[model samples]
Target: MFAIVRRHPANIAWIALNVALLIVVAGLLVAGSRVSVTGYYSEAAWNWMAGQSMYDTTGTGFLYLPHSAIAYIPFAVQAHPQGDVAWRIISLILFVLGCYRFFRLSPQKSEFFNLSAGFVALLLCADCMRNGQATVIMTATMLLAIDAIRRENWHLCTWLLMLGFAVKPLSIVLILLVGALYAPMRWRLGVGIIVLALVPFAFQSPDYVWQQYEEFGLCLFHSNRIGYEKWWAQLFGMLKAFGLEVPDSIQTASRLLCAVGTLAICFVLKQKLDSKRFLVWLYTLTAIYLMLFNPRTENCTYCVLGPALGLFYAEALCGRRWFAAGSMMALAVVILGSFELGQHITPQGVPPVWLAPLACCFFTLYAAFRLTSELNRLEPPPSREAQPVLE
Candidate 1:
């Protein structure tokens, strides 16, 4: 069955063409002519082109970096109502493409596995698209970057990572992780690319760019202090929701400790394994960490974890079948039941929050521990042994 699918690229292309048409029609039906915050992205783009700052106080203010506005420029130039719909439609397309790219780059070899992973990935992204969030674009950027890393295309990897970083600064963590895997050589290149990417923005407005950095930090600080509903889904907010009074000081300390501990474990694993094995663990772990540790991780941000979850599930199933079933149950709880579960636990008028992602949190750590268990005896991980299904 899988072989038949593989042999028919023409069939796949035709299916894709029909799917794209359906996506456009569906987007038009669901979105209508309403312009949401994604329009603010276009607003920021137009304003930037007019010599105004990207972070100006207009229409829900663009929280992204200056370079990120460049991506919205094409849509921004379109007329108002059309531009708004165009942005959403483009975002929808990116979500589909991102899923396809993720499956292709993933370690799930069979077409059935790839198709299943793609389905799960899109299901995970459903909320993100409904809200017209840029998280899908960020997901695509990460998927392509991972594919580049697998091909050892260091320059392509650097550029893709930068593109994502411009939208979601948390992506820098993944960039740093990749840098470590390739060590001194790739590290220099990755860092250099980041620095050079900033150079173009600096040329646009050196002083304003610096000030935008301050504004960006202040924005993050304010959002953290607010403790929004989405924040409740993250480490600090989860603690608070569980009746633990985590002060700002403790929260800061806890985040630092966890981040350092995660990195330390990854570094030790790197020493024990070669590039391929190390990358598999590194990418999966870092994806989870980006959402787990950060206070800004909203429901939409959870879309980024879809690929990591798929990778972990594949690895688990290949190893201990029972463990695979358990993880799937946990994931089903997260994907299907988390919202209602969160609503039942919280009071009226409060945003829905869930503790199920915490299950994923623990599973990530367990996966890392399993991967790095033989640090004392440095032989390659057992042949055909199930590591993370990350390419």
Candidate 2:
């Protein structure tokens, strides 16, 4: 191991940087559990073990499924600081490993690209790590599932998708999008769904499990209805900052329409591109949609798009698209600076919470144009008559 570390000095430095950041953030949380979202997970697990309802009727409490609480039991059973540190360490490892695997999926591989992209993603997500948000793990699972799909490892893909959904229900966007676009995933998705549903019953009484499921649906419903009242860092917030207030009904309709549009784009691309490129495009679209449309999207939620952006940046550099690469770097800077930017008042007289969404909007348009140009440039295969005969 020492010899290997000496051979790859850059890799060692990168890993050390991640560990240093994790230690700083996790150390802070050890003393103040109030700031970290892991408190919610711990509370939910405690409640489940005590036969109490995990769902918050007011739409502000624990938002994940009961099975998710079960997943947190190990951490919940431990005392503060220790459990918090353990959870952060696990989250950091999953995220770093997932990013490494996903970056390797790029058609062109370079150590510099991998290290730079991974570092940028980590910097952009530092706040999420400090807050102990489950979004970090959910993002990791999404990256791993995409890599699994590219490799045609359907069994692993199914488990990863299920784990993502259990961590954050919003992951349904990626789950459904991938299932619809890939034929091989259909049956595996069905089996995974069944297993996820049945797992809760095995641990708890059927009556209790069924009741929690019912409350889970209601919890989501209430959350969606009230989500607009807060100052979100999503499309609605971006619009409202400009004096255009969207009603709750319009918000719901817009989300549905965009979901359909995403599926249509994926279907078209699946036929035009190779399997690997198509998977990357699918993940990109899913990540963008989640950031812009998820009703409760917060600034920290932008972590979901960090890995996708990193992949795009590396692709631009490999293909010699200097302009595109520069744009990606600029977007990363904006995202890293968004919290600071939000401190100053904008021309609209509101804090610039809209900065991240605006960047996402530009990225969406740029990605569409790039995809269209690539498709137009693709050369068609020659027919047999047009090809020269071989001796």
Candidate 3:
């Protein structure tokens, strides 16, 4: 027994730590209905069976589209008469599993980071009001696609991306566009995956689906061209600093800029995407793009907090002491200005929605602020890649 213990010390230690964290998490969640989607998701779900509505479209001086309509599906799945307590509990559980899967899907088995990643996933369940699981589903799909493409398994990649696009249209652009940087051959597969995503759902209402395609343009124009003041205030402020409106043209341009920047990072900066570190950057870009450019990112939508927060917290596991100290200071500002920390999570910084994203950009040194610029300056990641696998 002594010899066995000596041989598997890290293994034993990690198991013990995971148990403690799991217990603490279960205790916190079960204490009460503290972290919930509130009534919003149920309402959206109920509205779906009620009228097949999309995204809080009830009291709208605005139009509703079925494109964002799937928010109601899980609620419909749970189908509690009260549509309140029992149903949300189920969605919350799914949200947890989704996060767990996302973290597990990461290439590294670093317990420090994996468990930290799991905690961040739990944070998604704890804070956000909108379909918290939606982002989970999206992350899962994107990660699966990344996995498939890395192995050059286009068949598997297509199926995974199809599920992602079916869940939410946002993945249609992010997964496909950003994916082309490393795996340009896979872009055609991406478009095919998107086309296939509609087949089964197409049977539901092909014309409505096509109409949603048309609405995509309107959605872009509405959010980009006609600005709404929400959490993205700082991000939009930066765009204004550039003397531009958030027009469809600018929306197109931003994506092009992100794409060009990504390519430049790969070619010019010589950043390589074939390493384990690639997903870190991929997810980072998707999250930041949402925060910076998405028309709205409410406090409830704090579900995306997992990837950024996970990367942020994992820095302590990194070998940077002073850098970690500075990150802690910056993280303090993020918590104070962004999250509600009353033992239960609430989104506090409505006026400063960009705070979380900006914090993510600042705090995650390995990816956003440092890498995009660094990668742009180098050759390509694979050639300069010092190790075959990046830690």
Candidate 4:
């Protein structure tokens, strides 16, 4: 192990940094610092274990499906501080492994690229880790799922995607989008969803499970209704920052159109790009959409974009695309420094909520241009017979 570490010094340093962070976060938790949203998750799990309702009307209420609470049971059962620290450790390990796998997906890799991109991604998502947000696991699962797709491991892909959904229902966007566009995933995803939905029934009484499902639906509906009435750190907030107060009807219409448009783009790219490129692009597009369009998107939610940005940055550097590398670096810095930058530009340093959406907009436009250029350069396949079989 020491010899291997000496051979890959940069990777070892990255690993060391993650270990240091884990220790710092653990110490903070033990010191009674309220650094995580794990309390809400623990409360929901406790409520479920007590055969009580997990849903509430508060802003910080548990908004995930019934299975999510069940999934949190392991951590929830552990005592405070220790439980929180353990959750963070597991999350960080998964996140680091996921990022490493994503970096491997690149056509070329080097010590500099790995170290630089890894550090940048960690910096971009540090707050989310510190806050013990489930988004960290969601992001990690999504990265792993994409890697699974690249390898055509359908079963693993299905399981990883389902795990992400079980952690945060918001992952349904990626689930449905990928299922619809990837032919091999369609049936596997169908089975996975069915199994996931039924798993709770085995753990609880049928009536209780059904009742929780109903409450889950109601909770989602209430959250959506509230999401519309309030401005979140998404596209609408970005627009509001620019003094463009779009009407609710228009916002609703725009969301529908954009969702459809995203599917359309993915469909086209599926036919033209290789499986690996397609999967990577698919993940990037999904992450951007979630940040830009998800109704309840918060500043910490921007962590979803960290893996994709890190991969892109590394790819740009390897390919000698300085402009792309700079753009990605700037976006990551903007997101990581949004609080400090906002103080000078916005009132009371209210961490410009618009910064993330703005970065997503630029990324989307650039990605579109790059995709269009690549598509135009490729010769059309003969009779669609040359396409690789994903299964």
Candidate 5:
């Protein structure tokens, strides 16, 4: 079935055209002067350059690592409206760079599949740019890290992963995922990331850096109450939103279930850790885990799932028919969940129903189940025909 897609180059071009149209339509929807989460980063950089404490900034707290504030200084120096536009443009570039890196690492046999997968991913994540969030940059660094690992560039991978963690501490788990995949290189990766992370702060003010780190920790602890509802707060949040009572023990139950499930999956795929298929599966699962298990995940944060889904769909089309079907179902779940159609699921009565909580939760479990099943299958994946020699 997919051979027809591979034979025709025009299909790839059509996919590219649709991607451009989606971007244009979404851009029109968000073309106003609304200040997004990125405004806080820009404001923090300006404050830090003025010798004011980043933690003391009024609007949204400068919750990221001190290095992020230092890096944003260039964007901050730009005058008013231009800085905002420049930051968005830079972020969009980073997003495209990340997509390009992923394709380079996993060069598929079918351009149609690759281009279409990426188009679907971009369509799903257009809002990340609209909101001027940092997820796109963090996601791009993650792709770079994956590409570095594929090429066995240990130092570059460590540096990219550390930059991601510096931008958003939740990405520390992704660092751990990298360690698990390349166990032998873990020590070198760990040391390089930590050293690079601290250099910016050490050069500035050691005492002030210490203070800001402490404040950052405290801010994270209380972030759930900051008013804006997270898109992926998991089962407990969903249950509470549906007006069901949740006990303190629900937290313990949730952790135990996740731990048990993770262990079972490891047991099943324990022998395939070194295979290319396992690597792709692990990458997708890790990204999905970040979305599902994080304490606070906004709609913008879900953009990280883009590459993961694209990888899954591309692989599935390469002869794993069941896997391909599962990937399409997961994609549908993601889009349905994104519609904000179930706001009645919230404690406060709001309009624009948001089903993300339910849909994301279902899709997360579904992907894990499908991955485990794929790992346990006895037959090897299908092989492709080699390209013919030119006459």
Candidate 6:
């Protein structure tokens, strides 16, 4: 086990690189996350500070929870010194903790490695630090749950999932889908989720909580698709161009098809996927999650594309993939999702007419192909050996 950890070039390189990225990009992300505390989260946060009822702030443009905002207590409309400091502190903690969980999820020998270098890797990936929000909390808690699963510590996994859900509902999907896919971790984690989820309601003012939930649901489905062009529109739009009349039905089916196809490819490949392959899978899944299940996502949501870039670079170094496509798209995201893009404010609605669904189609297909092969790489011991391990 120690030899394996020693063999991790990723960790050794990260020890040096991670600190630099955190000081640079992570710093930027933290600032970005806090910038427009204006939308729903801001409104609710400000209102809550005023000792008024806290209702759904989604319409105000806060898709995820105002984790730091909430903790700051009492509305952000009038800033207090302690409140501001508290917000920064929370963001820092979430950022560091998130880095820890992610590293632990990687190859590690001891719990100590899980605690230190794994976190360093996370900080190394620290792309979303400045504009951190509930997503920070979401990523941190949920990844911890995932790490716990890898450790076979269901008790801790449950607590992490609960912590994640309390920050953002969608985060629960990480715990649910991944845990279920890796089924053995189910029992304790699932129970922890249920209890943690329900326990919150007990203390939260019913009216306050219900109003927020109502707003979340309403804003969720009722929202317009006008933000950025739906990434899936490319394939569907191409089919439409041929007069095939692709509808939401086709959209749903396509996503399912992608999932099944990716899984099958992984199963068939049956090899340990290098990081680049993992990137392809991450991109494929993220693309589907955002385009199909996201219901409402915007340019800003592209922050996650960093992980894809990381994987792509890792793979490229291995002479596996060309850097052009990932590079260009990543540049596009950095340009669009960045603070600089806020000034443009062009009422560009969804169906991102400019996305050239053709581009999207090719990108999606390539990613799916990559991910499937990666999955096939993960090997399990034969049944006889597996039984003893399970026991």
TM-score between model 2 and native: 0.91
Task: State model 1's lDDT.
Answer: 0.64
* Tens-digit per-residue lDDT, 1-391, candidate 2: 1321344666777778898997788668755656788888999999888888898777887989887899899999998888888888898889988888777767777666776677768876887888888888999999999999988899999999999998888889999988998789999999999999899898888898899999989988888777788767789988988778998888889999999999998999899888878887888899899999998887888888888888888788778899998998898888777768866757645757788888888888888887888788786766667768799
Top-TM-score candidate index: 2
Q: Rate the local accuracy (lDDT) of all candidates.
A: 0.64, 0.84, 0.49, 0.83, 0.63, 0.46
**Candidate 5 lDDT, tens digit per residue, 72-189?**
7777787755665666667666666676567544446556556655665565567676666777788888877877777778888888888887777767766775676577569977
Give the Cα error of residue 143 in candidate 1, in Å: 2.6
Tens-digit lDDT string for candidate 6 (252-307)? 67757765664554444323554323323433354335433443433333333333
Query: lDDT tens string, model 3, 1-391?
Result: 1221233545355345444544454454455444544344445444444544333222222222343345455545653433333333444544444444445445545545555555544454343422333555555566556556556676676767666665655575555554565565466665775566465364356555565445544655555444443224335533443344465566667766865665455443324544445655566566656655555554444455454455544544443555764564455345344644321442343233445545545554545555655456655455554658768
* Candidates sorted by TM-score, best first: 2, 4, 5, 1, 3, 6
Candidate 4, 184-250: lDDT as tens digits: 9999999999999999988888888889888888888878877776767789978877778888898
Better of 1 and 4 by TM-score: 4
Better of 2 and 3 by lDDT: 2
Which of candidates 1 and 2 reaches a greater lDDT? 2
Cα lDDT of model 1 by residue, 1-391, tens digit: 2332455554375346436644754565456635346666777777767766566332125777666677788877877556655666676566555545555544556544554454455556666665566777777787777767667787787777777777766787777667655653376565766685575474467766676666656765666555543445676666656666567777778778877777887888777766556666666677778777776666667778776666556545545566664665467347545676778877676556545456556767666566656454576555785779788
Report the error of model 4 at residue 288, Å: 0.8
TM-score of model number 5: 0.78
How far is each candidate from the true structure, as Cα RMSD in Å?
7.5, 3.9, 8.7, 6.3, 8.3, 9.3
lDDT of 2: 0.84
TM-score of 3: 0.63
Better of 4 and 6 by TM-score: 4
Please say which candidate is ahead in lDDT: 3 or 5: 5
